[model samples]
Target: MIQAFVEGGWAMWPLLVFGMVTIGAAGRFAHRPQLAQLRFIGAMSLLTFVTTFHATWLAISAVLSYLSKLEDVASDQLVKILFTGLMESTRAGGLGGLLLIVTLLLVAIGTLRLTPKQG
Candidate 1:
């Protein structure tokens, strides 16, 4: 797990930061459901999703660039290398996505609290 994170390069660190902030905001919103918290959660959710894909694509691009630099590599070996890098790169996005899902669930719960009670 740690190795996969390390393989994600510098992008993982920022994604981690964003994910943590989003989770914190979402948790707060779940507890209180304030207008300001709602707005912040919405924005943070979007930011987290964008950062997730950005990190994923960045890692994929790096893999492709590295593959291009190789000369006369075996076909099977190349495939292995490509997949390994891709799998490693996806770790950041996967973690971000998991965080986003959790935060969204919290946001949904918070929204439920916003609905007026009826007899």
Candidate 2:
């Protein structure tokens, strides 16, 4: 995994940093709920999703590479399996990341909406 990231070049570094910051911000938000921190958490969650784009692409590529070599595999079967695996992986990571971002945004918005304006 480290080797893969190293080979992934400049893009991976920001991804790693974003992932770490997201994890840290999430942890802090869990420990303390404050409207001021919500924006940071939401931003970090979005950044994490962006950072993970490569993983999703790689998953699709892997599915394609594996299915391409299998002469016996039917087209429909291949498409079905590919989409199934892609959805599973995406839920585990891609969609899950988006869900986190949405959840954070909603929470932040709700909090702001409920808070009384200060004069």
Candidate 3:
């Protein structure tokens, strides 16, 4: 959400840039017939996974906070609750992201193996 991005501060800027670069790299590699393209694509995919994981964590934290009835709670208490939720979401998102990256790398490797070698 927009709110989450805004609240994510300066850290979000790099994530945005990473996402854009990843898209560009993917697009470029998709059209190229070189086997070496997979290395760049794989690296970009890893970066993309990192950004995606963080964004997911922030979104999850925002949604959890919004759903919880913390409106009347003290500021300190609210911060604590949000922090706890963020920590939990970070762990979950990190593992999910790692799994995704691994799967992507495996698929890329499989594709590379299937493609006929060029002289």
Which lDDT tens digits does candidate 3 get at residues 2-115?
554555444466666665565555555444445676677678677777666666666675758574855688888878877765654454344335445554555455455554
Q: Model 1: residues >4 Å from true position, as ranges? A: 115-119
Candidate 2 runs further than 4 Å off: 1-43, 92-95, 102-119
The candidate, 1 or 3, that scores higher on TM-score is 1
lDDT tens readout by residue for model 2, 78-110: 889878656543432533354466456555555
Model 3: residues with Cα > 4 Å off, grouped in runs? 51-119
- The C-alpha lDDT values of all candidates are 0.87, 0.60, 0.58
Better of 2 and 3 by lDDT: 2
Task: Answer with 1 or 3, whichever has the higher lDDT.
Answer: 1
Residue-wise C-alpha lDDT for candidate 1, range 1-119, written one tens digit per residue: 78878988889988989989999998987887766677778788888889989999999999999999999999999999999999988987778988899999998888777655410
The TM-scores of all predictions, comma-separated, are 0.88, 0.47, 0.47
Q: List, in order, the clash count of every candidate structure.
A: 0, 0, 0
Q: lDDT at 95 for candidate 1? A: 85
Return the top candidate by TM-score.
1
| Worst-scoring 10-residue span by lDDT in model 1 | 110-119
